[model samples]
Each structure stands twice: as structure tokens, then as C-alpha cells.
Target: MPPSSALRRFFVCPSHRAFTLVELLAVIAIIAILAALLIPVAGAMRKKARETRCLSNLKNAGMAFFNYQAENRDRFPPACERSTGSWRAFDTLLGYTDATAELLHCPLDEIPRVRSLRPRSYAMNDPLWQRESWPGVSLNDMDNPSRTILLSEWFVDGNTTGSESYCDLGNPGTFAHANGTAGNVLWYDGHVSQLSSASHDTNQQYYNFR
Candidate 1:
């Protein structure tokens, strides 16, 4: 048995004392502040992650275009050359890439213009409308392949007619992400980049293929 003094000291130890209400409230307040600070940060992180994923998907789509070009005599598939059913332009890349159909979808895509039957979230630049010079013009004819837009994160309509019908990112909602403005561009040279939406003019040299 311990001495009475030792028992009293043990029972009354400050370290073992219960927390005061004020202390508890302070701790809770600190936690609440931390959560308040972290929530938006966490959301921003998630949005950035989805943006990265969307870029990766565009990269895969670029690969598919390259592969399609390799087999199609260096010519890109027609954006809307099809005279038939409800096929979107990206469908022209389906079998060319080993990536599943999921690669064609952007994680940030919410306002899809077309049905999910073919599951596409990117739209091709339409050179076919201006001079009927899209799939007809081979990649060899491109002046600056690195700058020429091939595909972008946007909504697609039918087998053709996407993004802007001209590759202009001037619209407010043209290249929208889940949160705000974002434009993920896949160039003709098989590279992916985040481009400024308002930075491009429809007739900019970068948009010119010839």
C-alpha cells in the first residue's frame, strides 16, 4: 500500500486533471478554423488533380491521332467527313489508341453536349468548314505542327462541328472546366498543353495549318 501523501499526489496530478470548458472550447475553435482553412484548399487540390487527369486524357488522344496518321498515310481523320449517323469527331480515334474509351473523356466535363454513348469530352478543330481542307490536308502540309490545334477540351456535337467550328477559344464558356476557365489543347504534333482561352485569335498564325 502507498503512503497517504503519495496516494493524494497521484490522485491530484495536474497532468491527469480534466480539461476546463474554456480549454475544450479553444481546442474546438482551433479545429474549426483549421477545417475552414483546409476545405477550400482541399477542393482546389481536387480540381487541379482533375485538370491533370484531363491533360493526360488529351495526351492519349494525341497518341491516337499520331497512330491514325501513321496508318492513314500521314493524314488526320476527317473531323466531319462522315455523311452518316451520330458519330462525334473523336470517334475517329477510338480503335487507333489502345486506351479504353475512358481516355476520350475529361474528368472535368459536366455539361456534355453530346450523348455518352461514344463518351467524348474533347472537340477537334474544324478546318473542313473554311476550305474543306481537313482530312484532305496531310500533316506534312502543316506549317507549324506544334502550334496548330488538333483537339481541345470542349463539347462536341455530331460527327463534326465542335469547339468553335473554327478553333477560337474566345467564348466565355468555350473551354470551361468544372470550376472555372481551362483549355487543354492537343497539338497537331502530338503534344498536350494548357492554353490561355482568351489568348487565341481564330486567325492566329498558330491556328494556321498551311
Candidate 2:
């Protein structure tokens, strides 16, 4: 025989069950734990994002040099202007490319534009040409353009006469994007990559390709 009507009704419509206070607290605690776990990850992501932007700026700089070189019979821009005999590649390139001076400034560099147009955060490779006779040299005469560096983060060591060079290796501020372990370098062949502090000075060719 089938069950009574009252029994069938009870089975079909069971009373709603409310979560206990402890269960609600447990769910809130779980959410809090997950949030705490993501904090560091979020910070790292933001750092990497800034790093990508810095690299893009460096890449733009390298391309500008190429455009400069093509029009001047493959000769790279001068490391310093002859009128003042000071390393001001930024100024020289701006004249050639008609790009805003701030495009060459590193994003991480907080120096105000009014204080310094170039911000002293980037410098050209010293081996690309001689300060005395740069126009005579050409990129076609260089070797290993793929491995050679074009420009990198600057390192000021009190003696800045030839200090506007890409030799700011193994410094905390130079590699701001990588927690000071590695910094981004734009190679002569129009590619950008990270250069570790240890390997920065290991080979003379890394900086001195000429």
C-alpha cells in the first residue's frame, strides 16, 4: 500500500534549513584568507606591468637610433655634441627624430622634467663610437649587433665625465623593475632583455663591442 497523504506532503516540502552562526563565520574567515594570499601577487603584477612600460620606452629609443642611422649612411648618433663636448645623446636624437624629450625618460625615474629633461636614468653604449669621430663610424661596421647593448639604465658613481654610459650594473636603482637583480637592456639589434648583475661586467664585449 502507498504511504498516507500526510507522509507524502512532509517528504515533498521539507522545512528550510538556516546556516548556523559558526558556519557563517567560517565562510567569512575563508574569504579573508584568500584575500591575504593574493596581496603579494597583486603587488608583483603591478611591478611587472611597470617594467614592461620601461622596456617599451627603451625599445622606442633604439628604433629612433636606427632611423637616425639609416638617414646618416648607417652611422649611429654621436655620444656627445661637439659644441659642448658633453654626452647628450638625448638632445641629439631629439633633433633628428623630432620626438618629445620625455619619451626617452625612464618611467621609474621620478625626477621632474623641469629639473632635468633626460632625468639621467638612461645612457648610451660607450663602445658604439668615439666621442671625437662618431660620424665616420657606422653600424654596418660593428659586430654582433644582436648581442651588443645600445642603451641601459644609468649608474652615477660620482665620476660622471664618461659616466653617461650603459655601465650602471649591479645597482639597486639601475634595475628598479627586477628588485635590483636584473635590469632591462636594449641591444643594438632592436631587442630588449634583462641583464643580470653578475653577468653585467663578466664580459667586456657586453658593453664594449667596438
Candidate 3:
């Protein structure tokens, strides 16, 4: 049998095992502080992720536009054009994929009801292209794809008059308030990007490259 001293040592906990209440509280307080510091960062990260996803949605929509153009002899949809009574162009592409909503919308929008139907956070600038002096102006005529605003978030109405009606070709930006400063924009070349508050003007300039 082991000695009594050995048995006692084996059963007894070390002094380190017993933390004081103050020490335990201090550790918990530090953890709480760390969590508080990370909460905003985590939220920002989540927002960025959502923005990336929205951009991907725009890319898909851009592809859908190209496909539609291919099928329709290079003719693009009207900026405010709908199938008699429907959402914007994004709705027309719903048959292709499920990410159509992200192309039309941002994660920061407040109107849940609006998003629930078409799930879009952005609109197309087809109306601006409609005013072109020549026929079949085409998206390629733009000086720079990065500077152009092909897709954006704008106000939706019961009558379906989109904000793109106010936009213009070669000058692709709008003062629409449907989405906040940190909104997603899809370029003409099927690429999506994020626009910042300081990047674009009140009208979201054409060549400003927001």
C-alpha cells in the first residue's frame, strides 16, 4: 500500500487549482472586453462578405444580360422595362439562377418586404442607354467598364418606374437613395464592385470610377 503522505498528496488539489473570486472575475472581464472589441469587427467582416456575395449576384446578372443580348440580337432591356407587370430585368433572369436577388440588392437595405419578392438591392442603367443618339450603342462603347455603373440599388415603386430612367449613357451614376453609400455596382464588362461615400458624387458620376 502507498504511504499515508503519498495518498494525501494524490487526493489534494494544487494551490493553483483554486482561483480567487477576484481573479476569476478579472479573467471574465478581460474576455468580455475582447468580445466587445471584436463584435464591430465581426459585423464589418460580415457586411463585407455580404457585399462580395452581392457583387457575385451582379456578375451573374451581367452574364444573364449578355445571354439575353445574344439571344435578342444585341438588344438590351429598357432601364425601366418590365414584362408588362413585373420587377426589373433581374426578374427576367430568375430562371437561370437563385442568386438573382443579390444582384438587385444589398444586405444593408431596411425594407424587408421589398427584398422578399425580387430580393434585389440594385437596378440597371438601361434607361440611360435608351437615350443614345444611334441605334445599338451597345455596352462596349463605354470608355471604361470600371467607370460605368451597369447595376445599382434604387427605389422601387408600385408603378415600377426605376431610378435608371434618370441615369444617362457615358455618365453612369445616380443620386438615388434606395441603397446607402456602401452599395454594390456591376460594371458593363460583367464585373461587380463596391462604391464608397467619397468615391462618387451626389449624382454618382460616370467616369468618377466609384
lDDT for model 3 comes to 0.56
The parts of candidate 1 lying over 4 Å away from their true place are: 1-15, 81-85, 116-119, 128-136, 155-173, 177-182, 205-207
At residue 66, give the lDDT of candidate 1.
Answer: 80
Residue 8 alpha-carbon offset, candidate 2, angstroms = 20
Each prediction's whole-model lDDT (CA)? 0.65, 0.65, 0.56
Candidate 2 lDDT trough over 10 residues, lowest sum: 167-176
lDDT of 1 by residue, 173-200 (tens): 2446534455778887788887765664
> What digit string (tens of lDDT, one per residue) describes model 3 on residues 1-210?
766998899999978668899999999999999999999999889877875665566677778777766766676555432333244445556655555345555555545443224444555565434533334336556666556777665443333344343322222233233255555666677776667756644244333232
TM-score of each: 0.73, 0.68, 0.63
**How do the residues 38-115 of candidate 2 rate in per-residue lDDT, one tens digit apiece?**
998998887777777788788878778887788877788667543443555666677666457666666666534223
- Kindly give the stretch of ten consecutive residues in candidate 3 with the minimal lDDT sum: 167-176
Model 2 segments more than 4 A misplaced: 1-20, 81-87, 92-102, 108-114, 127-136, 156-173, 206-210
lDDT of 2 at 66: 81
Model 3 TM-score, all chains together: 0.63
> Pick by TM-score: which candidate is best?
1
Error of 3 at 200 (Å): 4.5
Q: How well does candidate 3 match the true structure, expressed as C-alpha RMSD?
A: 6.7
